[model samples]
Target: MPILLLGNKDIDLISGKRNITIRRLWKQPLYRGDRLFCYWNILSKEREKIFEAEVTKVKILPFKEIISNSELPHKLGYKNSKELEKDLKKSYPNNTKDNDEFQIFEFKKLHVTQWEGSAINQKNMIIKKADILFDMGEYEQSSLCYQAALEYDPDDANLLNRIGDNLSRLGQFGDAIKNYKKAIKLQPDNEYLYNNIALVYLNKGEPDNALKMSNEAFKINPKNTTILYWRGIIYEMLNDFEEALKYFDEVLELDDTDPDVWNERGTLLNMLGKSEEALISYDKSLELCLDDTKDSNTWASKGNTLLGLQRYDEAIECYDNALKIDDSNPIILNNKGVAYMELDDFQSAIECFTKVLVMYPNNPDAQVLQEVCLENL
Candidate 1:
């Protein structure tokens, strides 16, 4: 099953104005008689099947020769060779050398009645749809699509892994592990399959089991940073702080730009009562963080470190920054309330607790804390 993804050229393709598509040579080159599944890749990451087409011809030509042919650019719906060259460079920045080969696929659109394809093609189509759905965060729907594809090719380890991923996102840990284990059985040498199983066990609050699976992945690829990072996380969940810190340091030495690792290190340091060192890690995490949600978590963690250092005002400032990004987090709200309480501002503390209680009516700690604030006033 050959799939052709067109970006911003669906209208031209449908209108028959563009019959040829030039692409960098794929691992599997298109044949003249092959049925191509044409898809329009929308800017929002959505993919729509425009139509099925048959490859009428395929021409393999060097980049220099293709650019020298002036008439070919107009046939490709470009105004001139320069426009085509610009588009090609933008699409394939690394493959613009004069000697680089490009495949020009000339296709003819088939009628809806002529769109019937093989069972394998149908499986590929379903997998493509499932991939798009997964990217869109429709995990349940994507899982169902993957299941349908699995019926057609049950032995596909990649399909099993994809199904496991969706199941994990949906919090179906038991089923996720089942799929992951199935994948592992099929591809025992794949370290990522073992890591996936470890993650499922970790989510199920079984860090000991997670560590066993993670250790298998580590054995397969000891230098893999992802495996090292997960090993660090598993050790943290098992309360083996020293071992967790050791792995975290290993990861940082390999890739210092990972904000999540820095944040985890800060958390582990904070738990060990090293407030000053924790602050440094938190600051590093914040500096590297690009996501607002992660930035909020790092800020909240920094606030906790400041609070432990008895810097109530600085802690409150950090809490305020965290709240600005995620005002509804009850844990942060309660911590902010505690900061206020430490400053002897009982009324402000009560307000913070009240906000938490409003969001979570059954929050016993917030309820008790609010009463204590009232008692002080």
Candidate 2:
């Protein structure tokens, strides 16, 4: 069974047969212990009991998991665990998995527990809310909230670091760099802050600066995946493809299901003319991508590879997919039109050229192609 929010205040944990209100759950930060108890009435309407649980054991409900389970049989059992494992593997074909590993797709039911010292305090409330906002993509507001929180607790390393992260997400890379540096100054031994600073520099195309910060971060915490990712980005920007791949490969070993990493590795492989490896990377990315709609770059890359292999029809299909995502993309449209012309589809080529011409009226190549297509017609 799947959990769903009922009304505005209560959540129905259908699988657990429990209905609990948000107010009943113990908020943390001011709480003394990591356990919570929730008092709830079971679906049988005959028994009322409070359940105790650990905070770290709590899980948040996932929308995708809920939607996936909607049409399944109501009976619950562990019989389909093997199938679930297979699905996870398919979701990340390039990743390794243990034979007995199990993954819970969603969170545990919300409950109130006994023995917590105090409810969530004011400072904790603000921090939690700011984190929620950041997760929801409200970076500007989250950063402002985090800044206010840091004012009262300037020595708090985590708060300072998060403020830097929010600023970076808001595209204030310069400010983010400053905040990360401040965090490092306050906590000299913190490798995470160094990694964050390196990331901002990489985002701003300061590869040399990124390299310096990443190296320092790595020296402090060599096994830190975040620092490794920054180092990989810096190396990639510096055209040290081999070094970049090494870092990315390590990241994959740590967490192979990262679609972004696979896509990035594939792109570098393509640049290095490792067509087969690039294809594998692209396939892994496509498998992980939840959206059926193709991205402009995805289609363009696939089309370019197919063209290299002289698979004209397949290349045209990939370009068409790209055009569907971004109709105004002149480069893809032009290249697609060229593919059509190679297949002797003059009129179709003309249509693609015309679309590009609409976006760039003075595009000489489009004009020339249109003229040639008209002549052929």
Candidate 3:
């Protein structure tokens, strides 16, 4: 029987469910009629045989199509399909037939493995606690726990990488870089680690070094879309707008449904003073967007482009759409006020600016704009 290790969340899988598990079973010697054994909480050494299941069916499909499924996202315990797809793309870009997209392993979970709980090691317990903290957005506390866990196994590259990721998010750029370097020393070809280091360099305002690091990662995984996206970002940071656009265009060619790439392309076009072209790209991003896909930001960007083109009414409508998503966002309110002012609607402009002033008490620009509106009134 092939052992199917589970996480704490996977207990729900065995009781009586049939959610498709996403594990690399290509290397496993298995056929459709094979019995797959299950163990719950295996990572913490909880080698309890939970249940057994017969593999009735198995189909490998491209991740792009898999992520568009509504039920699959919740079954996989993801907030949304887009988020799940992004993660899969980053982790399993080489899993696809094309070697550019993710290949999802689809199977039905049948029965429990029949064993329960063994004591988890102290190190794993600490690591589990750290993972919980990290999930709760307590990066500092998580980093401390991860660091503490490191005492049990000083040479753990995964631990070092996790600590480095936490430090990077905490804005400890120097420490983050040190931890990433340590991980690299232990595991020389971890392309994701190199990419992580590149992000820190970008944060430190060193686009040159960021590009260099991204290039190194590219050498390792030439077809990773995430790395390609980062390269485009680095180029944008370095004011190489044309190069950035080219990379984003390439990403779109590979996967046109990715709103992030479209958004970046729109931003680059906007920077290049191609307002109409920018609007088209922004619209494409919006059209590709799913429910609650942060359309407010895209709407706001489109509004800004229209505002530059002096289409004040259209801009105001776009701003209104943005406000519907986040009614209390002061920045959007301020922009809407400016749009109203451009249309010579002094009353509406004053009302919008007043909202901004109330939300952000020290907004000098809003106050000044409100004063102008009052004069026009």
Top-scoring candidate (lDDT): 1
| Local distance difference test, each candidate | 0.88, 0.66, 0.78
User: TM-score of predicted model 2?
Assistant: 0.61
Q: Ten-residue segment with the worst summed lDDT in candidate 2?
A: 1-10
Off by over 4 Å in 3: 1-118, 290-293
Q: Write the per-residue lDDT of candidate 3 for residues 196-315, one digit (tens) a residue.
A: 999999999999999999989989987788888999999999999999998888787777888878888999999999999999999999998875546989999999899899999999
Candidates sorted by TM-score, descending order? 1, 3, 2
Clashes of each: 0, 6, 12
Please state the error at residue 180 of candidate 2 in Å: 0.9
Per-residue lDDT, model 3, residue 126, is: 62
- lDDT score of model 2? 0.66
Candidate 2 — number of clashing residue pairs?
6
TM-score of each: 0.66, 0.61, 0.66
